[model samples]
Target: MTGARMRVALSARGVEVDDGAGGVLAPWGDVDRVTAFALGTVRYVSFDLVNGHSVEVDDGAPEWDEMVAALPAHVDGGVDDLPAALAALAHDDPVLVVGAPVLPR
Candidate 1:
């Protein structure tokens, strides 16, 4: 089966105070999850991958909610769908992509 996936970098208008250990933190703000397909024009908070940092964001946005919607639906699809799905991501959002070994069936 065909599949897709993509995640753009998102920018934050908020402050990321450095942790005592020199790490960074995102205290949750607005968020938007945009893929190639948007049920409708979308505008909201965004997140992305950068050293596996964590942040908070609103879930009301189309992208964010859509991501959740796709989870159960993409049970047998490939990873390619991610790119198109994440196209709407805020070009500056920070996110982490952790992958594991999938045993061959």
Candidate 2:
């Protein structure tokens, strides 16, 4: 998440993240889901992989809007209440944007 400017891109293969230092490719078949949360005014988006790891990108990065807009193409249920979820950032809760909505208790 830290490094020059971040770049997030979507492709037929999957989500690609480049932080200027290095890059990570989260393939479509390997992705478990996607999640988003806000800390202060910044929004953090994560691509959760089936292998138990994840890649995160922030709103400060370029292509952030494009990536968010393209989520529905790759993730089930996409982000139905993104505006509302972001509005509730003061509560500091991470919302599930894809796959299932339920979070662990």
TM-score of each: 0.20, 0.71
For 1-105, candidate 2 gives per-residue lDDT tens digits of: 633576778776787877778887777777777777777777777778789987777777667677767666666674566545544555366564655222223
lDDT of 2 at 54: 78
- Worst ten-residue run, lDDT, model 2? 96-105
lDDT of every model, 2 decimals: 0.32, 0.67
lDDT of 2: 0.67
Write down the RMSD of candidate 2 (Cα, Å). 5.6
lDDT string for model 1 (1-105, tens) is 011222212223222333234534432232122212222443232233243533333334323554444432322234444534445455454442312112124
Decoy 2 TM-score against native = 0.71
Candidate 2 backbone overlaps, count: 0
Give the runs in model 1 whose Cα sits over 4 Å from its true position.
1-52, 55-57, 72-105
Best-fitting candidate, scored by lDDT: 2
